[model samples]
Target chain A: MSQMEIKNITKKFADVTALDNVTLKLEENKIYGLLGRNGAGKTTLLNLITNRIFPTDGEILVDGESVIENDSALSKLYFMTENNYYPEHMTVKKAFTWTKGFYTDFDIEYASELCEKFSLKLSQKIKTLSTGYTSIFKMILALSCNVPFVLLDEPVLGLDANHRDLFYKELLKNYSEKPKTIIISTHLIEEAAEIIEDVIIIKSGKLILKESVESVLSQGYAITGSISAVDSFTAGKNVLGADTIGGLKSAYILGHLDKSGIPEGLEVTKPDLQKLFIHMTNR
Target chain B: MSQMEIKNITKKFADVTALDNVTLKLEENKIYGLLGRNGAGKTTLLNLITNRIFPTDGEILVDGESVIENDSALSKLYFMTENNYYPEHMTVKKAFTWTKGFYTDFDIEYASELCEKFSLKLSQKIKTLSTGYTSIFKMILALSCNVPFVLLDEPVLGLDANHRDLFYKELLKNYSEKPKTIIISTHLIEEAAEIIEDVIIIKSGKLILKESVESVLSQGYAITGSISAVDSFTAGKNVLGADTIGGLKSAYILGHLDKSGIPEGLEVTKPDLQKLFIHMTNR
Candidate 1:
């Protein structure tokens, strides 16, 4: 098991501030959903943790050891970036051999099995692969890397519906056999909501929320009723947002709902993760 | 309004066949979901319809006229391809102008409005934009083209949850106002299910199913109960798939599910679009 800590981390690029004094601790063997709007600094934080880039301020540590210039500490982590960095001429088979050299603990046999499972040809050149195959190749490497901490950035970029389902199921199966701290930075929040145990949200380079998925979700409730009645009931309440269609209205509230005080003809249900994320992240 | 007819289209690349003997009619003023697995020839079909590539056999027509070298027929259609074909140094403003030349009906004001809504700067160069911004730029063009037939491929590739929500809502708003024939070829089936009136599924270069989304979902159901009861009840039914956790079991069944005939402990519910697509496309 491994834990990662970010202490008051801030990253600056030229004149822009990418991440601002963000501090969070990742528990051991937990799946985390790193979510934010575009350019909200999710990638910047992940890059800092992997030592690909340095923070303008603050410290990042894995197991109390700084990852900066620390080969041993970095070796225990695998960061599957959005961009492919393998040699263009390298075949999948050769790439596996080459990655095993750096990741030492990488299971070559398991990688071959995954390649077959995804129907990827080992002899196919990296540059010849389609966008979907390119993502699959990188995912296969991350899964077989045998690292204590793995970071996946938009893991299912071009995958089809069936392939995405297979990837999620395989991810769960692998996590069950060998627990690891996995952080997935993706825009597909609903697809990852159930699989991820914890959620970390950032906005405009600031950490807004960090909590278990269930606890964060428990704070949101949706009430549906006539527009006038909903407006009357939700006046001055912590209403996140609302949608109205003709005479009907659905208001999303961000606090506990008293069941006894509820108006008749009103319906209350749990808002979905994606809807909650949108309401929280919308400008 | 415009209609597209794909008559016995087949495409071949070298020794491999991409699309084989596919025939389907895209009705006027309806949103259709073009769904398939990766390498299932969804893109090939779209490319053929747009005259980007020629079909090896049969023909494609837009408004009852052949699209091959037919400028008037092609002018009514807009295909938002997966790749960005604009010049590397072209600004978003310039790209909008260039597109307007070919697509004379392009609405420059609406394009600028969409750019503002998405926070995309007109001065930013196309090659300098991020993945999310790139997708947003293309989507803005597709929505503001003012064409009678619009085809979008993976329109929300890297959009965040908030942006995707905005896009879907905008798409529906635009469709309601313009009432054009639109075909969305995307991997996010569940997100597109409600907006898409009909679904056209293909498997291994062959047309598999074409029906209304409601009709397809109505034909499938999910049953949940104890393992023994689920297995016994599904023994003679056409079971698509099942999942078991400890003593609990959930089985997916096809065909009509008689409400009163269901076992007492079992629960029946409609299957989601993603689940149904996965079952249909999985090997």
Candidate 2:
């Protein structure tokens, strides 16, 4: 029953505000989708939590205890970053050994198993691995650390289709066996939609929405029909966006749908997460 | 109509073969999805076409002429490579001027227009942009070059969902206005599936698939039902793969499916591009 709380956090880098009066409570044993556009402060927020940088104002607490240079509280978290963690000449085996010092529950056997599954050789130097393999290596470290809170940033950055599928399945399997609070920030919204339970969306360094995936998805829908029919149906509603092809049209609406009020030729379907994200952050 | 032919191409690096004997014909004015896993020789093929790398044993011809050390033949092509084209500290405007020297049809006005649309400042240094902006810069160059053959490598690497959508729309519009041969090498299959006219899948330095998207997608299907029912229906058939969850099962088939022959309680769906790709290249 662990929980992390950010109380009115504000981060500023010189004149630019990276995060503005953002507050959120993250509970344990759940997967979160941290979504935002590039330079929207997703990475900045993550950095603040991991003590890589200090917020201009605010208090962060884990289980009611502050997480400022407090090794015990910080030990529960693992951040899988984009930058290389190990030196160029260090082998995967050596990096595993180095990680064991920081992570109390680091599982070397599980790491070896993952390497075998991914066909990554432990003897190979960190710099020799391809982009996809580098991502795999980082993912292995994050999953094998056995930490309570895991932050994955663009985990599938260079992975192919099969590897991506494998990574998702493995992540789910690991979560099911040992439930932990996981946060994944990625641009591949559609692929990671099903894996995420709750979503936390930010725009321009400001918290916009935080809700369960089901509730968010249920609130928005797209209607396709003749231009006139589609326009009439969405005219007064909270229209998100619209696209037209000749006399046909599809309009995205963010509100309750009256099932019986639909026009004869109109077809309604749930809008995908990407469409919703684009519309929400476009401004 | 312009056409490029890769005839019996074979590339070797010291002791290892980078690309096996491969032959294919690429027609003009079509978008080709060049897909493969890492180290699958996709980049090798592109380099060979650009005459940046030589084939160990084969000939490449564009418009019935050799492309080896031929400036006139190479002038018709523009390669948006992963390596930085401009030296460090070079501005976007300066790079455009340098490109105009090589690419005869490089349109400075169109490049400026694209920079405005993509929100890329012409005066900004190439090295100072973020990952996403770097991608946008390259995409603008590829689209504005007006080359007969444009090869784009991971064009949407760091783009957000909104930017990715904009880039795809812009690409389609550009292609429609001026028809040319465009080959995109990317790992994001599902998003680009609809935009591609044909798919070229390479695996382990060999050409495994070369077919129109329509034919390849139409050939595969998935059936879901009870485990026993699915097994019975797919037994001894051209089954690609299957997944089972308790008593329920879904099997992917590679050949034509008899709709009427499907079991009474079974459901069917067209298999997506990734599923087919995973099954084809897993070995």
Q: Write one digit per residue (lDDT tens) for candidate 2, span A54-120.
A: 9899988888888889888889889999988689799999899899988969999999999999899
Q: Per-residue lDDT for A166-198 in model 1, tens only? A: 899899988999899999998888999979999
Top candidate on TM-score is 2
Candidate 2 per-residue lDDT over residues B112-193, each given as its tens digit = 9989888899999999988889999998989988989999999999999989988998899899999999999998888889
Clashing pairs in 2: none
Query: Residue B243: error of model 2 in Å?
Result: 3.4
TM-score per candidate, chains pooled: 0.93, 0.95
Model 2: CA > 4 A from native: A224-236, A244-249, A263-267, B225-232, B244-249, B264-267
lDDT of 1 by residue, B5-49 (tens): 899988899988899899999899999999999889999998998
**Weakest ten-residue segment in model 1 chain B by summed lDDT:** B237-246
